[model samples]
Target chain A: MATLELRGVRKTYGTGEVVKGVDLSIKDREFVVFVGPSGCGKSTLLRMIAGLEEISAGELLIDGVRANEIPPDERELAMVFQSYALYPHMTVAGNMGFALKMAGKPKAEIAAKVAQAARILQLEALLDRRPKMLSGGQRQRVAIGRAIVRNPKCFLFDEPLSNLDAALRVQMRTEIAKLHQELEATMVYVTHDQVEAMTMADRIVVLNGGRVEQVGAPLELYRNPASKFVAGFIGSPRMNMLEVAVAGHDGAAVRLTLPGGESLAVPARDALVKTGARVTLGLRPESLNLADDGALRGKVEVVEHLGAEMLVHVRTPQDDLLIIKAPDEARIHPNQTVGIGINPARSCLFGEDGLALILRVDALA
Target chain B: MAGGTKVGGRREGRGWPLLSPAVIVLGIWSVVPLAMTLWYSTRYYNLLDPGRHFFVGLRNYDLLFSDPGSLTAIANSIILVASVLVISLIVGTALALLLNAEFPGRGAARLFAISPFFVMPPVAALIWKNLLLNPLNGLLGWMMGLFGLPVIPWFSTAPMVALIIIVSWEWIPFATLILLTALQSLDSSQIEAARMDGAGPLARLRYIILPHLGRPVAIVVMMETIFLLSIFAEILTTTSGGPGDATTTLTFLVYIRALLDFNVGGASAAGVLAIVLANIVGLFLMRSVARSLNR
Candidate 1:
């Protein structure tokens, strides 16, 4: 296993730069997931690290050796493409053992390695079948097995599970996580699905607009998003954000106002508040509740029952909609005026520039 | 509504009236002549003299079997088709691979490559014969004089070689065009995946591209075989089976017997033999290739 590093790596196609000045270090045996929205340069960065794309500027290092000039074959990295680009004519055994055969490995060793990988992937019965005979999930296994036979310095997965069905994707996700642990090889995976990154990554690098927005564990990003974008991206059903203005401040508690004569005295940031500063208040769906002693009242627009919980899309007097997960099967009617409980402690406040306003523990206590 | 209906399921198998236009055209254009040929194959019938009739049935067929000229014609036909098809396939597939590669002015190069197929066969034959391989005045002689190399009598020393060259030149563009289109449509991602699997250039070609080209190569071979088997005009214009029957093929032999020798019975017999030979070859080939394609 080798430590891979990218120092201000850049890539441009014709005119517009696809991967712009990226710097990252992947430690040995570390599983790093590059998570982003589409066109955020995650796959391009992974390809650059694998030496598939030419680095326009800066350098790439593998095990302290500058590898910018090395070709992909010489780089000793295997990539599982999003399409599971298996050789159509080759059998499962042929697809997996092709690399070793290319490398001039001994016949016995090639056979042994193929058998081992097939056993790991439960592909013993499928060894003689061609790719056309295999299902999508089986083809994905073959694609992964093809990568496994190389035993390269690192394994790069470009959304390897995207083509499988939902159930297969989850199964293969777990299989890949187990494979990483079993191999203990350096891996860099790129996916637009943050759930994949959140579930599988040791450290998820959240990227947006070709820049790394935040790098942390899944729960760390969920609990303390560095910016509003990360806040919206990291959580399921997405965090709700609404524009708000500072009404006034009262020591640790501050008064905020919405449109149409709406006001509430919620908690304040440790930093000094400006009266005219434009900010967005973010609330997770599970953060609010409906109770008799509630602080904010809104008309229930849509009520969705999920057996275990209910989601009420509540419309405030200012016409801002908030989705709250009522922890029980609350049979609420739509168009009925309902009051919502508030927890300022669970809500996040962002400045006009979308930077997180770090909160203190003493104020919540 | 009653007239517009398709009638009964019992009338399903009796749909020939619905197909009568096509059947009538085919009968007029194809079946009638084939039946005439079959009838003529069994008689001494001539279009020039309808009354000079005799039932000299097996005589013409026996004469064809015994005649060394007719046998040599059949052999030459087989040799020409086999040689030309192999040559065109290799040359065409190589051209396709080269055209598939990314290069400067590749579009113009491809246009130049496929232009020869569009050249009318007779015109193409004339160009190769009178303008290209002509012993004295052609470009080959001119180039030979410029390079101080001995000018070769292309038609005399190697008659079949001349025919092979002419056929390949005419049909190579077509074969190359087919193979090139197939190569262009190949998914680049699959090849990239192979490359990442540590396959070098030769391995990629042998294991990946060749397998992908299998069905297309089969198609080129099948289509080219049918055309090459009856290559008549090129030989007719160039050698005309001259210099003691050195390049006489089956079609040329039939033409000589019917048009030159005026033996319509012998020619009809030879034509039947030619059809049988072609069917044997085609059936032998279709068995293998149809495994990869629809009949």
Candidate 2:
């Protein structure tokens, strides 16, 4: 129901600028997740949007209204904190009904709203219990229920699921996605877990070192990253990077010599390719496969079986280790010589700068 | 079969021997004086008439209770403890909240705020008696004179008020120290969440900070009551229970019977009454504290 716009929003403390000039526009009902490594200011950016932190410079607009000076509660936005920050002295019903009480709502309205939220979060029987009596997952649900009772214009989550166990993290992840579908409210989520970002967000904003690296759909960022940082951050079993030199150019592609004396010609901008210039080649683990008479030859160092897929770590003759994702049933073992094939069209090339040189192309192109 | 059946109380009989040293020390320290006081309270023993020690079965208590001054002294004790407790708590909580805020020189300010507690009781009374409330050339008199107002004698005119002020000045620092420590442990995220929930400053204090300080405030009340109930030094130094029993409390009444009147049996009777009164107050206070803590 609200569109959030941050125009050159920067946060500076003393002399250190933590969130340096971020500009983003979140459309109404869009689930936007800010994904970054720790200390990349993703949480700080979310706090600024929540009005919990002051925007030192630049403007923040909510639904086309200037909201930088508005207080958090006045902004009509609810935030779920990582710590679950429930009032330990209050009962679950009391905790969920606090915001409504503060707004001077009638007692009956507050009770009804809290009841509805407790039902939505499946916490009917635990209303009288305090936070200390509940498990971690229940506390997390109470935090979300507290926010849900507010029925805010947007929802801001600051790594809410990061504190749960792995199994519970996945469960809460899907529950939050389902909640978003049911509410149709704008959500700005922040997490270091790219998997959560990939699964929950309609659009992902990748941040690194206090700057937005790229913003796009999940598959779009996967297929066409804007820079080396985004490619390394957005995927699990990170994209492999190798230092290569430009061997030649073929019309719209750049030819490069990879490790183990294998040559790869990846489609990149021809204008940025220079003969004999040093470049970086980005290859996802799935882009490399085991094949007979493959270009790149290596010795398998380790094979990891992951039920449906196995990751084979291959050591090239030059001591360069590369990982290849293969079917779990593939007969791969340690200390075996293998030839690894590369998919040229799916590969990425970077010049001296870490900016990706590949243009967005069809997956089968 | 006996060992198996005796499952709970003193099953091994080994704990008492290990715990005897402290028990013996405490028995000699407390039980002996209490027993002697009880014995003396029932006997007609006077230091002036040493040869006339005889059993008098509640006669001393009856005489002491019949005196109207004894009633006044009891009321004075209650008034002093109650007023000091109220003043110290309200002022101490305000000071604690102020000191908890982040400001330059806060460490130095906190050190100064709790410095009055470090001064011994008699010394604090002496300072207040001579320098501050002294009416004749004291700092307060000088300040009043500067405003072209007549100096009002504090000890002679309002002796009980003077005593309460000096005692509260000493105990407020203690309340602040405990309450500030409690305030410091309050989670910052809780405050931020309340702010996000639209609680203003006063609401935050009412709903969050005060409830967070409930246990510490109870401790302060119990401890201050224990000490303030037996307040003697400030009364002795400034008012000496003076201006015709205006500031006389139960403890001073006991002192008067024993030392000033040479009536050992009567003083012992008053002392026993004081102990009973303290236990009664302590029983109620402990029950309330236990209930709050359980909640």
Candidate 3:
């Protein structure tokens, strides 16, 4: 078992700092995914953990021991790169056993370990095939098999499924999640896809502009985001944001005025907001429903049918574009005037500083 | 005919008119000289006895096979090419690896390293014979004397070795440049993966870098073999076929027969022999290069 802890770990290239003072602790056998946009330093943080990039300052501890000076091989971590990076000249078996051979393992032992990893990765039939001879999916499996043969303390994956087709990406995602369970080793994964982060991670760390926006379970971040960035990033089709003015405080909720003079009272802590102050209203597409006599009035702009569910884009009277998810049976058409309904308890309110006001949810109670 | 073949044939038909000018020019340039050489090889022609020319089919071949000096020249040709090819490849690979790294003045250093290839062969051989390899006052001899080493006269004592050295010096830059370009194309991620796999510097070179360089090295070998087979200027300037026949390659032997002895028939026969030898070597090298490229 291995526990990775990063205390104020930073990476700077010349005058610019890419990973600016990150503090995190990954528990043993836990799968932590670092998810962010491009240039958010998620991959840079993974490289620093793998000892591929030098940590500019601060300390990295592996299993409670300071491992700042440790080399990558000595750190007992294996990485699966996005490009696979398999040795083109060597066969699958040779690629898997190279690390064991470098560590002076005997021939029989290396062969046995390579065989086991190939069996686990289902690469036994491809043992003699070079990397160029393998398909993209098979090459990805061999890259993972090479990492598995080493039996390192932790596994780091850097956007391993980005090069795959959509179907293959889903298939490999499940396979990687299964592999993590079977190995029960600490893993640090980096991806820009929020769905991959939500589905595969035990804990997800959302980064923006080289800093952690929030860190929590998938549903926890979904139900109660600590900032506007997390709320907008963690869902598909993106949460529809509208500017509003705080009307008043109502017990545990904040009453707000929408753009079209309609009001919304969202269930959140009222201490961080003042009346008549402008704040952003975040409504998930799934939380918004189409109704005949609903509160918010708008014209249906576009209707997208997905067999089971339909996403209807509406332009409100205030010219704000909003997406509402409806059932397939809802007869919605473009340019049709319709009223939209929002779930107050599921909605979120953000102050002017882009920080989400805390939500008082039933799950927390 | 198949539709695909018909389409391909039409495309080639259209391309031929555009390509015929170059093709015809090259055909005449190579075929005319070869025809003349073949025709002259079968005749008994001499500049000294110009009026006594006649058909002497295979007589020049018989005499060339019987001559001891001609056989020694053949052996020396093989020795010079083989030795120079080996030395240049090994030293070139080492220098390419060294120059691939980051260092101060690396741009300038690479410029200096590759500048030797720009020097004309005759000029380079002159510099080596006078300023470097000369026994009396050359830089190499003076350095050897400072280190308390015995200095032997290079051209007079070991002409074949001296010729090999000069040729290797000229060819090493070509090898290094080709291999360096191939080295740059190697994926940096592959090296990092090997590093993370616990391979040290030498292990990475043997297992990763060298295999990556295999195809390019084969190309270097094939190109160098073709050019090295006809090496003439360096030999003409440095040792001029040696104190005896020690450094006379087949190309030099041809020059000696036609110019020094004025026997056009003998020189043509030697030229034919050189062509046959070069073709054999080229065939093997091309096959090996194709194999490596396919790999």
Candidate 4:
């Protein structure tokens, strides 16, 4: 029954503010991921929640109680660091049992708890071996086993899988997801990998420059991003944004001229856009198709053929480079001139401030 | 087999030539003196009457083993080394932990903590004897006078303790610097993990910090033991084996036998014993280091 609430929480180091007024609520047993690029203050926010970093301002509540001044040990939170952070001198069982021993648990209780955690982590056979004798994945499991033995209220993971190889990372990702189900504990994970957030999170909070850009389910963020930054960041093979001039507005829909002088209309009933005002148009690569009467014309510059699909890099008439996902069997060649069609209903329009313009369904049709 | 033999032959041919100069220098510097000492230990050699020397076999060694002064010297040597090792290791670890914490003036504090290591042994002994612990006009004497306590003559009454204090002061910096470096190399994330695991300060030190420092502490002990086994300069400068050989360590006793009494054979036998003792300790230290490395 652990829940976390942050009210205008901030972290300032000297004159530079790293986490600026992050207000969030994490539900009980929810796996919430803080996803962002490097230096986006995601780790700092997690550290603050872990009570490892001091909150420069505002409040943090755990289970409906004010916990800003509490030390990490008393806060009942466990963090798995990227480096695993296992004690090299101790055996796996010892490392897992240290916290319980420190809390004055009897030797039998500590050993029993450690044995249970080792069994859960499939580390029973390795309990007597020191950390240096374990492989990277084994060490990581020991770190998690150490955390599990404590049975904290919340689990915080700071890029825990970033140190593993690509194959190991995917394996550990599934392991972590399964662990979340087994424990049913509230977990706050921080990572720069969008795919990890997309696959593992119940909800992902996207941050940029120490501010929360958007928060939603993975597909919701992928389908309907709230900002141009989110639209570009949340999706693989990122959405291409082109600068366009507003042709006119018909009170219900706004019309814009593309870079190649092709005009398109988008639903923007709530957008305060003026005629002749320059705005940005966002088009996902998958939303594009090859049509005989397509308005946008471009020459294919490069072709990357994956097993199921091909990424077509196109140069438009306006010299803008764009990516188009084509069917794998479609034998496209470089320097081939083609007409690329954009689906306006599946597109997005951003104002000069990079804020997404709310779209009405009828106008989208 | 051919490939292995070729590689081995090439390595032997190239390595031996490259190592020739070092081997030659070591042979001249160490082996020659050792051979001379071995020869001298077997005869009644004396600088005072070189022409009257005779074959003594193990007589010098027997004399050394039976001498009450040599026994006192051996005991004093063990006491000094053991006391200095204990004091420096405890104080050094504490200082390292203190310096590892973030605080104002930490850089300057570390500089001061490591300054004594740079002081030469004789100079350090002199500074302690004259400026810090002297019975008449030293700072400690003045402090005792202010408290209405009698000034205790350190070298006269507590010569071994005085020597231990002086040696520990000089060696503590060496231990502190090594331990501090080990402390710095400790993964901060591990400490943070310990905190998150419900361990407080003392728990973290007991379970994490001390265990992590094991290898570095072993190294410090090994190095300090090697140097402390033959500590001569401090005693020569300050206590000079004291009022009744209270602080006459093995090295000082050998110096007295060879230079003062001109009993070269006796001194050489003592030197041979010191070498054997040092080797036993070195073997133990090497085994510990090797075990840690394997771990």
User: In angstroms, what RMSD does candidate 1 have relative to the true structure?
Assistant: 3.7
Q: Select the stronger candidate by lDDT from 3 and 4.
A: 3
RMSD of 3: 2.1
Model 4 lDDT per residue over B1-295, tens place: 9999999999989899889999999999999999988998989989999798888899999999998998898889889888999999999999999999999999999999999989999899999999999999899999999999999899898988888999999999999999999999999998998888778888889988998888888888888999999999999999788778899988998899899999999999999987877888799889998786566
- Name the lDDT of candidate 3: 0.91
Instruction: Encode model 3's per-residue lDDT on B37-132: one tens digit a residue.
Output: 988899999999989999999999999889998888888888988898889889999999999999999999999989999999999999999999
Residue-level lDDT tens digits of model 3 in A1-365? 79999999999999999999999999999999999999999999999999889999999999999988988888889999999999999999999999999999999999999999999889999999999999889999999999999999999999999999999999999999999999998999999999999999999999998899999888888877889999999988889999999999966778888787878777765457888998888888988998776779899889999989988999998999999888886568899999988888778878888997756455344
Fnat values, one per model, are 0.67, 0.59, 0.54, 0.92
For candidate 1, what is the DockQ-based docking class? medium
**Pairs in clash, predicted candidate 3:** none
Error of 3 at A18 (Å): 0.9
What is the DockQ ranking, best to worst?
4, 3, 2, 1
Best by DockQ: 4
Which pairs clash in the backbone of model 1? none
| Model 3 TM-score relative to the real fold | 0.96
Weakest 10 consecutive residues of candidate 2 chain B by summed lDDT: B5-14
Clashing residue pairs in candidate 2, if any?
none
- Of 1 and 4, the candidate ahead on TM-score is 4
Clashes of each: 0, 0, 0, 0
Tell me the TM-score for chain B of model 3.
0.94
In candidate 1, residue B180 scores what lDDT? 94
Tens-place lDDT digits, model 1, residues B1-295: 6654556544754886797888799889988877877777888866577679888878889988999998899889888888878887889989999999999999999999999988888899999888988879999888988999988899889888888899889888878988898898788878888777777888888998888888888888888888888888888788888767989999999999899887888889999898899899899889879887642
